[model samples]
Target: MSAGTAAAGPHALEELLGDPFDPTNPAGYRAAVDADDAGSVADTATRALDRWGAGAEFVPASLGGRFTAVDELARRFRPAFRRDAGLGLGYGLTSLMAALPVWAAGTGAQRDRLAALLAAGRPVPVAFHELGHGNDLSANALSARPTADGWMLDGTKQVINNAERADAVLVLARTRADDGPERAHTLLLVEDLDDLPARGFARLPRYRTTGLAGCRLAGLRFTGCPVPRSATVGTVGHGVPTALAAFQVSRCVTAAASTSLLEAALDAVLRFAGGRELYGRTVADLPHAQSLLAGAYADLHLAQATATTAARALHLHPAGGARIAAAAKYLVPLLVEDALNDLAVVLGARGYLREGEYAIVGKHLRDAAGVSIGHAGGTSCALTVLGQLPGLRPAADPPDPDLFSGRPLPELDLSRLRLTGPRADPLLAVLTDPTGTGSAAGGAAPRTRELLGGLAAAARTIGIRAAALPAARRGVEADHRALALADEYARLVAAASCLGRYAAGRVDGSPGGLPPGWLDAVLRRVVRRRGRHGEPGSATSDSALLAHAAARTTAGLSLDLDPDRVVRHRPHPPRRPHPSRVLTPTAGGTP
Candidate 1:
């Protein structure tokens, strides 16, 4: 199936929200958010949730919710974000975070308890981020002390979303006093917000945020809040791994949210550009505006594809989900932020006007700023990626060949993958450096042939080594340095593919044609061989391929491809809404 095709199985939660772009019903998406009425956003979201019978929207069918498939949930939840940025984020993301601890580490009883609360229409918010410490699950300071009947929790959880209204808060706290690391902590359920002060827990006023306003992110201080022993969500001291896993899932959804936000902003900008005249022509007719539009469009598509790919990987391999999620979280935000800025450029001065209906553009741009910072910052993403890579390294034994065959390049699709156009030039420069000569290109004037041969050999060797390692360790980082190396290797491979395609095409009289099925076949064979060779061979073989590809492409042969030339430029035509008036019928138009 194509990448964007709906996954085979149940319909997604996003599919349930219906079409948000209906023009005739301009307020079809509840503008309560635009009115700056927090209560209205929350109330409208709750009504929509209940009306769609989306109680099981986030819960897996195994837990008794409507969604039996993650894809379905992702699809269903997408519309909410598309409709209203703040409400979509509050309903979809905040709720998911609130419910994740239960899904990851909750005991059967805990799961049942939390699931029941959600069913009762009480939204829960997750309290995982603290002031200074970000994504370091091991640095949490909230403490939970054991008592005869339960435990006393004391600490301050800052920047908690939905703190004022959530039925419960999943608080991560250190149970052991020792400074071994926050991993020695437990997840505790805090249930009475109204009585927080009496229990020594107080809620600070919500912080003024640029986006996701309806969230009510506030600080909660637990002076000495008490909880039953059963409040522990999972095995004590295992909270870090559980929380990390939950973070992986959350990152995927967050990326999806970013994508939705970009899409909405792009749609609005496109509509405005079409009719707004500048210099005796529509802004859309300007060359620079077209360039900006194209770049934003390409970036938005790339972000969607990358995020969706990461989501699919998470669904299939929930074990190594963290690393994949980290990659998506890091890359997608950067993509969306750039696109948002480009949209502003496309609009010029008109985009800056806040008193009008399009004020949300600025709001979204501000909201998008948080995605790459805070708990989900780039540093945190890098650390998580580093940490998770080690866990994906293959064990020191040979893995079954069949295993590698079935899981060839599990994390990336070789067929359609292209070297990032920007990186291609520098890599080519390195490969073709005159001083290095054959050392980099690995041969003489026929650089393409040499590069292809080197790529094949490296693939063969790595394939053998990978085959030897245990299947479970293949995707682990092993170390920070290893991740950097792997990233370089992936980049080099992409560059070689680009250059190789250009080279082969030149020889075949099809200057831009890529090698027919060469990339896919070679990658498949390499992975198969690595699976057979064991752990050591995997690294050795990968390094060999990198070295060879570098040498083959860097020789003095110029491929004449300009990385600066944006290839996928196109202006978005305005979307006109059907003359439908009913909300229920309009909902069905959403995909």
Candidate 2:
């Protein structure tokens, strides 16, 4: 089993929730479409997760909860995200992301208070995104001026999730008047919003969203609101560093969460393709359709490998983690978006529907788009990776095989996270500079070795070109090339991670392991994704892998490194009044 699935082994959430197609539970796929009332739709999932004691999952064992490793944590939360991104965000992820900063720099009292809030199922909103500044944290207009007693905060934060209902707020505000780039903003833990003078604080109206309709994307404005000095997370003017460190961790988890959505989307596509008749047989039997399905399956695993490695770096190699984290955040969403878009073609007209059993597929697509652009977004993450390219050097020692060895992961210490360090990445080093026999991977299949060889060549070429650019020309002229190189490096990391998983028996020669031609299929897709001009190889080999995935998914088996028997799909029973709303019947009999 993968470390993630292994961690979720004893959990009851998956069993109780069952497949999205199940009939008995009203909260399955059928109900998900009908519960589309803007602010109230996500309540069902929120209540379910609360009942499951999911709050405990967000806290660390040392803090009196069950979080052990970042990878395992992502696995535990994937189900919620797969069901509804809105539910994941409004219900938990927002709060979890907010909690990370506190965990990283908070005092013991602050940590204790935050833990208590989580255990009580209280949502803590992180107000880092100022719509006015557009994710430019340093440019935020929200100001906190020191007073005789504490600080008087003024200014507004927009597009914050769960802003109105959160028990406490984590505010990123400017503390210094000087416009200097460093140490201008400070992070404060604002508590007891109810105690704020009614005249000083106000909640703005929630913004309607094109996606995540269930989320309350609202704003908050503070006018000289008083906050205690004890609310300060770390030292004065250190908020920028604290937030960046937290982003490195949260972004990796966010990427991992996106994979779950990809799996669900693929599940929907395979079901449609396997049952629908195209020519003489099921659409899945068609060569082109099968090719699409297998490519997507390979893509999902490749993204998972990269994301899982980045999560592992939280503890194993925290120093070089910033670049890895940015790469995951930048790559996973775009990949899953492509995967979903491909499936949309397979679904044909079904992809356009807004309500029905399969309508959740459309919702998943829209929600996935919002996630990529939300928070750090794709552009921000790409720039972060690009900025690091100029300073990167191959690691002095090769990356440890234990990182992707697919063994049980070690517990992480978030306090060790850094904002900046040497750009030497051991993971990419394994690809760029190979030791004789490739440590622990000496016995890997020849095809797998070929993948490593291709990856090494790509890295060497990218390195030479990236280094050749003068530092002046490297800024804007190199944007396209740098972004392409970042993507190539990410693919190499994914390939290495897959090889490691195979060596440790996580892939274990199963069909899920990119067996033989599957690896070639993945590399071709990667090269094409990088906009490279190359011969498009035959899909004959990948067709078998796609067929395997379709059969397994049809039987309700998971597509991760660890395969498990899953609850088979049960057709939705007749629709009842949505627990949230009573919709008038349409001209058709549906809903």
Candidate 3:
């Protein structure tokens, strides 16, 4: 388990891939493409990863592995995400999703079984969502009928990652068909798919996808499959609660991992822009290019802050953590998609090409699209937020400093995770606390005060709307102001995350923390997104922060804290003038 420490896994994984872009290396973009066609990582990469015990990060320390903290889990998985989205989802996150339920609510034997399998670098597929009822696990059609000695399982699950090759599957089935919504589903730990009797069950064929081509997206169909009663994961008729509870973890991972992928995309574009010449100057010298890079950089930081804080809140604020998780899942991926779109304009044609120079940009963009829309799409998340609006209130105290102090968290109490939490939002507290240390009275930055003011206004607006909406109209009004408040809630939460991180730094009395300018840049973007334009004393600009991010990327370091040093590609030299050379948008600035 020592090797599974926060820094160890990512460091070892990074060493395994080396510099993916190094022309002299075999494990570069070509390798990724080959893996895509084969629908798995290259044998050499897999063998190397297996040897590194990368899977141990999925198991808890008490279970003989090091899955202690959510933040560390996200950090450790960065190398996989940075390398290739298909391989990352196929090889890592999917397995984590499969194991989370057992860890959260499984028996000792179940946890041990999952821990041993993960420690051995084996795959585990979590089959939850059905094609007919996406995100609505309560409507799952799969059935586990009671038998004399066990349950007979029958039905199918679709769009599952690694389903075809999973060593075992965590299945959700309808256990009490005649029961109400809450008692309808049960979670089962089913294995021995390869050994099942003929005609009992079969693995569905893999489904091709537009992105993450290497991922084995497939389905499963069961026909009178018999399994011992021991297969039941938790209390009978509690499957819906268990599944919803587990989502708080998986959704955060999806958002965090996707953000990590976006960082790689941003790096690729930065590498290209730094090297290319536009007219008489480098593309990085163009005002539009600079602004785009700044916006993307700021967006990435905002997302990182949101993800980090929410992951911490899993332990720090267990009461309402599910909503926080939903907000992160809903908001961060969209921000990443938006960031990618802005970068696409900067990359021009390089963004469109699927192969060749800067191909990873296009590949990552496509793969990221699925993540944005796959699990609990934006609309579903909006509904989640909308439903929770009636319970929201300004926090009485400031957000706990531990959430953003960058310190280690205590062991996560998965059992403490709730399906629904009080509407109280601590992030919003940062905006409402008049006497907080960073308030304008304490001489905080003017931009910070203005941003806080905007948040206060937005909160008032949402509170009023949430109060006025009758219970019967909640669903019908969701499309109108309910959805709008949900959007604002997301932005407010993100803004609060940014400010909370900064405030935590102040609480620790740490000198030379994130500069005020960075906070201002983040808040400017937050307010702009909230539809509160032309706020007085808007952030000046993010030019300096953008330059700093570019330098960090050039040095092969991530924008987040304690960045793992990665393989940095040397910038391509400016192209020489030639009669055969074309300067169209499709022809990116340099090779």
Candidate 4:
């Protein structure tokens, strides 16, 4: 089993929610459509997640929760995202993002209290990004002044998810105004929001977003809001490192779980392609349509592979996880967005629908567009990666083989996460080692080795180019050429991850191996994705993969790494009232 399937399995969520294509299932796509139309999410679906005890997936097993592995946590959250991106983000992900830092550095009392709150299914929101300052958390204007009793907070944090309804809030504030910007901020976990307004806090108005519209995207204004000194989540003047580590973890899992959007889009396109006909043949039979569908499937696989590997790196290589997660957050969403658009090519008019059989496709597309810009925008992620690329010389040792073996890993130790990457990138060693014998890879066909040879050569060039750039040209005001090099480096990391997964399959020789030529097809897609910057001679026919996609879709099997049966079209189950409403967490509550 994949590490995640060991814990409750994504199939559990899939089964409980039933077939999304089944128009009448209360917790299915039809309900999702209605909710989106009404500017909210379906209570039935959110409640189904609650019934499944998904909240436990957010807290760690040490803290009496089910989230032992980051990979499993991502998978466990997949079904919710596949059902409704808003449901996944608003109901659970925000809370998890809010709690990770606390788990990483909070005192024993803080950890225990936060765990109890999450266990009881309450949402805990975070405030970090201000409207004026995006990912540059260092420039944040929120200030928490020290006083005898505790600290008094001022300024407003805008565009925060669940800001109004959450019982507690985690705020990243400027704790010290000093020359050392890195140590100027601190994280404060403020609880009991109900009393904050009575003191000096004001809940700000909601901000409407194009995507994730259902989220209560509001803010908090503190005109001397009083929070005890004990509210400090970690050491004083260490918010930068703490938030940086949390960002790595958050970027990894969010990118992994969000790949579900690609899957849902593929499902919609396949459904439309199978039933709709233009000339004399079904759209699925047309060569052009088949090619697009197959390419989209390969992209889906590629996106999932890259995302899952990055998440897995958290356990296997937390010290280097920052760079990989940064790369993923920078590239994977665009890949998914590209794949969605490719499927939309096959989907045509139905891709525009928001309330029909193919409504989920359009909705997922809009929601996915937010993934690239939300939390960490593309520029921030790319810069994070670019700054580290030059230092990514291949490590002397190979990364842990279990990184790709799908084996269970030790519980993710948040303390192990680093604000900076390692002296060398271990995962790159596999891709840069042209000789198959030198890598963690098992024996492969001569042709596969040739492809690796090309990739390795290109990767060396990227590294050299990145290393050549002057330090003056590598900051936030970095030139376009430097950033482009970073983009190329990120793609190579993704391509290397694919090779790692392929190598594991060879050693594993498992029953659930992917379709033949799946590796070649996906590699070429990456090359194609890279355009003029990619390695040569990797492109190959994707016909067989397309046939596999069609067969899998018709058979109700997922077009991902794992070959699990999915709920395809079925007679709609009996319908029940699905009231559309925003998420309502218990406020003014204690953990």
Candidate 5:
């Protein structure tokens, strides 16, 4: 088997399996995903826990959790989950979501209590989504009323994973009837699964889902389910923000899981290409197969990197981490989808069969389908959040350039750039006229300029890569396009990093001013040049690149540096074009 194969050592599959759950038993988990028997899959997952380890993966060590960083957990879980989608989704993702209510909004006491409960092997399921309500917590029809002693929860939550097996459920309920935002909603920790009020909670039969079938995502109904006043996770009426904060973590984890699936798909395609012969040669020798494999690998890397960055951001800035998390959430699932489809093409007829190991591919494809549509809401929701960022405006007209333009290119004041201290020194020296200025004329120092120049040159190299495209049109498939977009995003982030270095006084910058509108000119050029072909793009195409760039620039600006210019664009709704709308059809009815 290849080194990247799912059966590799425990750590190799950790990214797919998550939880350091096990190092040697991944194949067993793989069996769970492949088993024709549903009960067997659930049984396998329940027993697999011994190897996966205990406690919520994202919870802090102080809270009796094993995971210290979200990235570490992501890497470990990616492989295992890829091998067995159902096991991963059921135990890995559902656990992450179940733990979020307490981590994001629970009181200190609540956090300790919930953490302990999880450590003791009691799975906590989150019941937030309901039928017909979409994923909006504010639109929740579930009601919680206060009694003399406590509160009674009356409502139903649909598509709850592990609901039938949960020891406790972090239930979201509307505490107030009004539509206005207030202390109207609350999250209650409901324990005692058996004692759940008579007919208050019912577990509907598992829906025949396309993927992640091991999870018992049954509909749950709560009719006058009593909850204690102390059972509230956070303040009453703050469930919306609390739930959203929890979603940030969920988005990050889900992105990681999707990345795992992509990696698995890529690995499968690589092996299949090598062994499967066609036209008197192995498929691996074919140019198309090679290109597909390469493109898929690149996308896998992009997904992993993006998820890692978002996970780190979650640790640093929990409050405003939504946009970054959403970027990964929106991007990774699409990447996995493209990767799987490409793999199917490479596998040809064998890919279509469900008789062998390849059956997992279809299972994974189904499981991944839900990643974009699950609890955190769809890509549309993610775009709405991106629209709120500074300089993103919706498109106003047909063939709208405003969808891609309006944001100024980031500018940095070289003179204000700092090499080490918080103040600008090297930049000031360079900008100062050597013949007539204070520092420059005095020949105070030249090292800062040299360093700044070197860094700028490196940044330009990245920018060049971002701007370049292969001349061969055949190579630019959907996966390739996705990879290229991610690459550009990385370059933008690198530029932001360079800017931040200068701002931090890592390099001196008090550089002279540029010609008026120079920054605007550059921005316009970049936006116009980006994806000029109008190829169908991922849901996060524009926003992901912009968000990454914005983040880098924001960090750089913190160092007191300035970009030549900053372009802010209005947010535009995602574009969709139909055939009839674009061109006339032939009389034969063929377009």
Candidate 6:
């Protein structure tokens, strides 16, 4: 089997798109910024991606497209997300979201039609929520009443993407209003927009946004619009469950790729901090600035590892992996937003500029902030975990070692993914299982072991509280306090992933071991991010972590688990070997 994402080698988009830094390149950062100013996506980027068949990323490999697994899909799209978050969402993610449910539970003809539309370079937007319901999709007001021939759709699905121009739209509508919340809805791939007259269906005006200005966030209104019975996706009344299964993939893939938004922001700050002078020295010379930059860098790595491990879980254990997917989606975006805030500080006023080289820092800051709430948001995702907590199977074996391995993952089998399954979370075992090689007995150093023990204790405490929660309190009805438990549980999941990755590097500390002190710094970060009055990391260690950040940038590489795997639009040739001697994820980051 091939090694991880990088096994694809330098992505074609990275090479074909040209250096984003080149001021003259029409598809470069300047173009993206300029397009954002005009409140429209850069047409140059749209056409380039279409010409490159970027839509293929959404199609399944079996159907003549590149999609195979969630992680691989994330890695492929990183090159795009790192460029313009709007482009990534408008041209990439939205289509993937609309297509996934079809892949998971559509008639063979529906899947084939989706494959063809995407191949023709058209984005099919999924309309799951209305403006009134927001993340509470269960309350969606759109109605798809059953007709003699098929169904008649009515009401507005606001806040949808590409609604104004797409030839087709995938909509979720109430087919049985009298049924329970989960059974009232159905998914329909509505096509033949031209078949309906103005009164039957209309495209609403584009909604303005504070971030992702260039994205076309529009709406579709259907007033007694008719669609044949073939429009039904999956089974009638099973729409909610079908959507849930597909969400496991979208949550993992989109959450993982969204980190590149912060990567773009951090890249801008590092570039500015190392060069811009302040008080007779470059900003990089300031200790305080170094700490902020380094801490942000460390946060990025943890976010990457956590989201990625969740992606791996989708493949290795889809039955009980929804919690991990939810956890990663909840935490990574928050981590990226906080990191962007720190980076904006280091960049100072220049970070706010909209017309210069550092424009991306300001732009990405806004885009990354939007990421925190996208795809039903961190709060909704946390609820997803809270509902599953009481069912967590503690005796489940630790995550398969292959979860960390850089090798190729199995193809995504939507058939195995469900709305709810055995909540056997192996990542939890990494913290609670003291005898397992992933934790205290995994040859971890004294400080590392101590941190693991504390987190393990916290994990146990949450398990107890979860068991005590009334069934009513475990779901969407959960209060703020119960939601906080989900947040804490997610933090512990991230911690376990870090420790698991470090231990998997090697118990004997051989040639392929992770850098000597990396685990200490990250675990301390995890601990510090916990409950109020959190633990503080040492200044010296934070400085060392900053040095790693600096070294990687100096060599034009990523700062995450996969240090050697460079996917930036700027094709900076190797300057020199990294000074830290960090091996790419022997079981993580690849190429």
Overall lDDT per candidate, in order of appearance: 0.53, 0.72, 0.76, 0.78, 0.51, 0.76
Estimate candidate 1's RMSD in Å: 14.6
Q: For candidate 6, lDDT tens digit of each residue in 98-160?
A: 999999888899999998888778889999988778787778889998889999888998888
Model 3 regions lying over 4 Å from their true place: 1-7, 435-447, 473-477, 506-516, 530-540, 554-556, 572-591
**After superposition on all CA atoms, what RMSD does each candidate show versus the true structure?**
14.6, 6.6, 3.6, 8.8, 16.7, 7.1
Give the lowest summed-lDDT range of ten residues in model 5: 558-567
Q: Looking at candidate 4, what is the lDDT of residue 324?
A: 89
CA shift at 282, candidate 4, in angstroms?
0.7
TM-score of 2: 0.89
TM-score of 3: 0.92
Worst lDDT run of 10 residues, candidate 6, spans 1-10
* Candidate 5 structure quality by residue, lDDT tens digits, 128-200: 8887877656778889999988888777788888877787788888888875854578888777777766667
Model 5 TM-score (2 dp): 0.64
Instruction: Quote the positional error of residue 511 for candidate 6 in Å.
Output: 14
Candidate 1 Cα outliers beyond 4 Å, as residue runs: 1-33, 37-46, 192-199, 372-374, 387-591
List clashing residue pairs in candidate 6.
404-587
lDDT (0-100) at residue 276 of candidate 5?
55
Query: Between candidates 4 and 5, which one is better according to lDDT?
Result: 4
Residue-level lDDT of model 4, residues 70-91, one tens digit each, is: 8778877778888888889888
Off by over 4 Å in 6: 1-10, 391-393, 435-445, 506-514, 530-539, 564-591
Give the poorly placed runs of model 5, Cα more than 4 Å off: 1-30, 36-42, 56-58, 317-320, 392-591
Q: Is candidate 1 or candidate 5 better by TM-score?
A: 1
Tens digits of per-residue lDDT, candidate 1, 1-591, equal 121223321123233343333322333333533534443363544465555555456665566665443333554555555556566665546777767767766778777777777666567888877887766667878888999998888889888877777767888888876646735888887776675557587778888676656556788888878888887887887666666666666777787567766766765676566756554556665566665554454455445544654555454444444555676677667667877887887776656664454555665676676655535775566545443332222223222222112122232211121111111122223224333223323433353345445553443343244344444443432444444433423323333333333223322212222122223223233222231211112332333332332222233111112111111123344343334621232344311
Question: Which candidate leads the pack in TM-score?
Answer: 3
